[model samples]
Target chain A: MSSSGITPITKSVTPIPASATVVEAARLIEAEQSTLPVVDEAGRVLGVVDSASLLKALVPRYLEQLSHTGFIRQDPAGLLRHALQAAQQPVCDVVQTLPEYLQEGASEAHAAELFLHTGVLAIPVVDADGGLVGVVRRVDLVVALATD
Target chain B: MAELLAVGVFVLAIALIATERLHRTVVALTGGAFVILIGLIEQEPAIAAVDWAVLGLLAGMMILVWGAQQTGIFTWLAVAVGRASGGRPAMLVLGLTGSTALLSAFLDNVTTVLLVVPVTLVLADTLDIDAAPLVVAEVIASNIGGAATLIGDPPNIIIGSAANLGFVDFLVHVGPPAVLGYAAAMTWLYVRHGRQLVPEKERLEALASLDPTAGLGPRRDVVIVLACTGLTILGFFVHGLFHLEPATVAMSGAALFLLVGRPDVETALEGIEWTTLFFFGGLFVMVGALEANGTLERVAEALRDVTGGNRTAEVLGIAWTAAIASGLVDNIPFTAAMVPVVRDLSAEGSDVTWWSLSLGACYGGNLTLIGASANLVAAGALNRANRPLSFVSFMKYGIPATMISMAIGSLWLLLLLAVE
Candidate 1:
């Protein structure tokens, strides 16, 4: 009910659903340095986004023109813009949700393992009902320990 | 004349390895080429003594490790350990050290350390603790742990093959001392770094927040391979039933694992450490050339003379001297070259010299930060991961741990010799 203990600067940043595209994800990430963006729908956490997943989505752009010609009605660059602009898709659709995802009620050590396993900077924290609580960034953890 | 050349090549090999500016495989390969070019070793004899068996075995194991890493199992297991320890520094240290030792005994120390380090760094970062000490503990634990089994450390592998010592032979003989050495190391860590414990509450909160699904991957046939591994270790001691080489058994197990529901070919190939394999292949040729040129024989005679032909005194002398030398030079060559010396010493009535050599070469590696390949690999890996583990800082813990373990090893060697 109260987010007072949470870093005040992180409180106002809203999490988007996993369906969001690279364009939208990048925008959200840039707007605030919220390293973790929990993907949710109707308050149920589906997946999370970090810098890694965002960078991964941008890699296929060069191939889009050749591979998706029949599928696209617009020009290549226009298609790229459209792909980047569409934000309705949930984060889970693009997010790496397997194996490294931190489950609700998991320990910090478990979270650490996920980061190591995936070579990611942050992991999404979920609650008992698979609902989004908040994100735990690597820097956040470091800051916590440094301050504690 | 040829003997001098061999010694020169050997020294160059050590220098190139110590400077770290060149890849080890390259340095060794270049040294191997030097031997061939100088005709220090003829082509026929060079190929004859070149132990492809050792290289094959190392390659097979590297592929196995690569496969395991691909599955993310080790990292996952590390996470589980971290989760269980809940960031209590002492408990975390104990868990990391114990697990690393156990795993290193079964796998190559470098591969094992490489797999575990990332997880350790993540734990350190998440816990907001400096990971240097934990990493240091891992390096020490890995060396000690690898000493427990015949197939664990590179020197042990060579010893096993050279002496025809079995896995059980290593477990019964060297294993106990390795465990004892591990205990001594733990005590040292407690006295030095135990006060740096992080809060328990923070650990619990962190534990409660992990998302497991993010890292899950397909599980391979872990059960069968583990059983085969157990059989392989069992075969080490029970040589009476059969005369199978440990490498043969390892290869057989690996083959069976592949033939019967193993991971894909690409995955299976991941287990081998090719760079290390190349390094070993090249080193064999270099050392072989020295042996051929009669340089190794001269060095052996000199060492024998220095110890006054007192076998027990010689074994202890070599053991202590190696412990000191490894802190300066790469232990792999030091140990490899000593294999023949120890063999000769044993042939001359000091049967315990081989074991002493094994103990010295393995434990002596812990004396300095750069004393062992595993230490260097761990440092490089940590640095690449943006969490650098410095040499001076590593020595802060390494020096004492090395002294304690080496002392125990020296005393143990004396006991083994006295009883004989």
Candidate 2:
């Protein structure tokens, strides 16, 4: 894939298992400061969970349908309790399924389209069997274009 | 013979739509193209067949509703109703479902339910009660409330435009039945689920602590949208007096909002349910072909023969048939096919067929999970909230609601016929 241009940094990111708790996934992201791919036992990617998805998980799921949240006010203690309860669910439940992903040997333009279309933090680069080859972070794609 | 072929294709499409084997829009569009492609009628007549006025009205209202929706006013109203209910189970149920009916009276039922169901699911969660009952009631109320006004439901819109009826016409003929049906539906709901809606004391306290106005958008946008909504409804009422169609009134409101609201033109236009409008377009062409071939007149004559040509029997028969057919299939296509037949059945210049069809079709939408778009939309919302309402489960409530509404509508039609 890099033959055409800069490719995903395979060594920089960490992968989280599909069965991991939302708390575990959040911690992994905090420690890595990168998007985490949720993978099954065979190392196939299910979807990616990132800070945005994690933030979504912390609130009531109904918030997804609501147009505004400015009115939702809770005491910190109560809100923390709610978030903790929310974080205990399996991370798979909150994973944002990647619709447009980069395949092995795909060009950088495909990567840019996924970023532009989904506005996702990262686009997973998968192999033929849907194994996680790597992810191209939004920053990496932008910087590659800027400096190319 | 080509008319028979056209009829066959249209029936096959409706069956496919009823089964949901394909997207209704796709099926409708295909059916339309097949009839014309095979020369069922010429291109010019097919173009003439599509009711551009009804499509215009639907599109305009969609933009207007979305503009108001952006103000977060519906959400705010729903929340405010919940807060005002004092978390009392009876009051809460009544308030939530009642507000849904009120909203459906002005906006289309789908938009009404889309806004109300989410708030209901959230409120149910906060109060720790089952949301299913509340949602079912709201959906049923949506159909009934939609029947009372010309702009409230698609079936009524098609009926009004086809028959040259107006907003005031529907309110005079169907509004009373709608109010009675709402009462009957609410009573049935209370009787069936009253014992189960009890929220925990602690949850009630938590709910009370939340502010109802918290979700409101900017004050300015809310005021403007509300004023426009009021004006749109007002325009619908008097448009006939000014020699205007309802479509013109709705489009004018939409244009005014676009000019003043300054919402992204793209976003505002995006709110239109293009698939539905297109589906109506295709269905209209197919129905027009049927009308051109006198298929609808045959249907009308056969229907009249069944009722022995008595005006009272004719009115009640059309009403009940429209209800059952609408319940079994999606109401839009059924109403589309029936409009011409209703026109044919109208004897000596009476408008009773129009009102009966409107009331029966709208009431019938409460009969099954597949009966109306609003019901299906609510089911999807509930399923998303992990509170799935199945087809059978819906019918347990739906059957009685339909029966009650139908009974009321039939009697009201009969009473009107007797009086006149």
> TM-score of every model?
0.72, 0.92
How much lDDT does candidate 2 score? Answer: 0.85
lDDT of each: 0.70, 0.85
In model 1, how large is the Cα lDDT of residue A63? 29
Over all chains combined, what TM-score does candidate 2 have? Answer: 0.92
User: In candidate 2 chain A, where is summed lDDT lowest over 10 consecutive residues?
Assistant: A5-14
* Tens-place lDDT digits, model 2, residues A107-146: 7777777788887888778888898887778887777777
Residue-wise lDDT of candidate 1 within B41-149, one digit each (tens)?
Answer: 8878777756766776676566555545554557666666776786667778888888999999988888788777766765654565666678888989999999888
CA lDDT, candidate 1, residue B327: 77
Give the lowest summed-lDDT range of ten residues in model 1 chain B. Answer: B207-216
In terms of DockQ, the best-performing candidate is 2
Model 1 misplacement above 4 A: A1-148, B208-220, B235-240, B347-350, B384-386
Q: After superposition, how far is residue B199 of candidate 2 from its true place, in Å?
A: 1.3
lDDT of 2 at B222: 88
What does the i-RMS of model 2 come to? Answer: 3.9
Among the numbered candidates, top lDDT falls to: 2
